[model samples]
Target: MNRLSVSRLFHLNNRKLFQALIARYSVDTGSKDYIDGLVKDDNVVVFMKGTADQPRCGFSNAVVQILNFHGVNKFSFHNVLEDESLRQGIKDYSNWPTIPQVFIGGEFIGGCDVMLEMHKNGELIEELNKVGIRSVLLDRIEEEEKK
Candidate 1:
């Protein structure tokens, strides 16, 4: 083959190899069993746009704040922003079309608005209690009542 033909062949082969590598490394890890195991393994699981310490969106931050308010510091979090397939997969898994999905005791709890409402209605405390987590808000309220 001439030099030109050989160079073109090499470029095409490299392009194919690069695409293959991208596809291989970016395989989606958000299957039903994977998500199920993740939620089941942790009493509190948050699928949000960012990490607990640095939430990317307001709703994600709100979810993190709500959990922190209840004294839940230890929980699993998945950053959907980092994974496109997982982002879509989580929505499909919970049948909820929003980020910042909460799971308590392996049950799908709604997004930030639902969390806020539940917090206001005292249902979040109940849900946490079911997962063996005692809301610190309860203690704070009791202390205030004693005052």
Candidate 2:
């Protein structure tokens, strides 16, 4: 084959290779439009290892606890383990390899550890306030009592 033909062949094969990999976790997503909508609806969405009530991993559990500590009881959660496609797709969707990934108002906010550090330093509260999810009033009193 001429060099030009070889280049064209490689390009075609590359395209197919890309499609095959992407297809592996591609959801009909049509029937599940709720996935995208829910992620957007909540001011804080956590794609963690499990749900808020029964977090599976230590990291996920800690994250939920941290939010609860601030009196933020409600958050959207996607359990990656429950759905094979979601498990892989979310990693790709967030462009982040780790779980317990937090999303605040349609923005990716890294993982649990990142969140914990931010919380300790008061940045988490700042961010949450920016999004209008203020920590409950009792939370303020409780935190003050601890200090």
Candidate 3:
């Protein structure tokens, strides 16, 4: 082929390839925003289906209770159902496809079932120990019963 003809063909192919990549790699801005918020609020984060006081799902309620039982007095909660973007965004953020996902110190701790298992065997205490939040059930009861 002539040089001009070859250049035209190459340009056309390049444009098509660029368009295809653009179509395939569209960014989900809403989900990205939600995930950023979740990860940033990472000291103790629970991506549950509902609020802390009134958990909307059984699994979430169990998780809240478990954390409370362990005396994790303060924590942040994201209600995934309140925003559809958050529901999907948290899965991406934690790489764990489940609600009631707990994160400690910006790391993926585990889900509700995992938390329960760990709490049962005192494994959760070890994990919390690093952040200086060990289970202090008796201590809390003595000093702070209103929590």
The candidate maximizing TM-score is 1
lDDT of 1 at 143: 100
How do the residues 86-142 of candidate 3 rate in per-residue lDDT, one tens digit apiece?
A: 687778766788898888877788998899898888788788776778688546656
> Estimated TM-score per prediction?
0.81, 0.70, 0.68
What C-alpha lDDT does candidate 3 achieve relative to the native structure?
Answer: 0.80
Candidate 3's error at 76, in angstroms?
A: 0.3
- lDDT for each residue of candidate 1 in 42-130, tens digit (9 for 90 to 100): 99999999899999999999999999999999999999998888898899999999999999999998999999999999999999999
Candidate 2 has its poorest 10 consecutive residues by lDDT at: 25-34
Off by over 4 Å in 1: 1-27
CA lDDT of every candidate: 0.93, 0.80, 0.80
User: Can you write out model 2's per-residue Cα lDDT over 15-100, one digit (the tens) per residue?
Assistant: 99999979855644323354567568789898878789999999999989988888888888888888766776677777788788
TM-score of 1: 0.81
Off by over 4 Å in 2: 1-36, 137-147
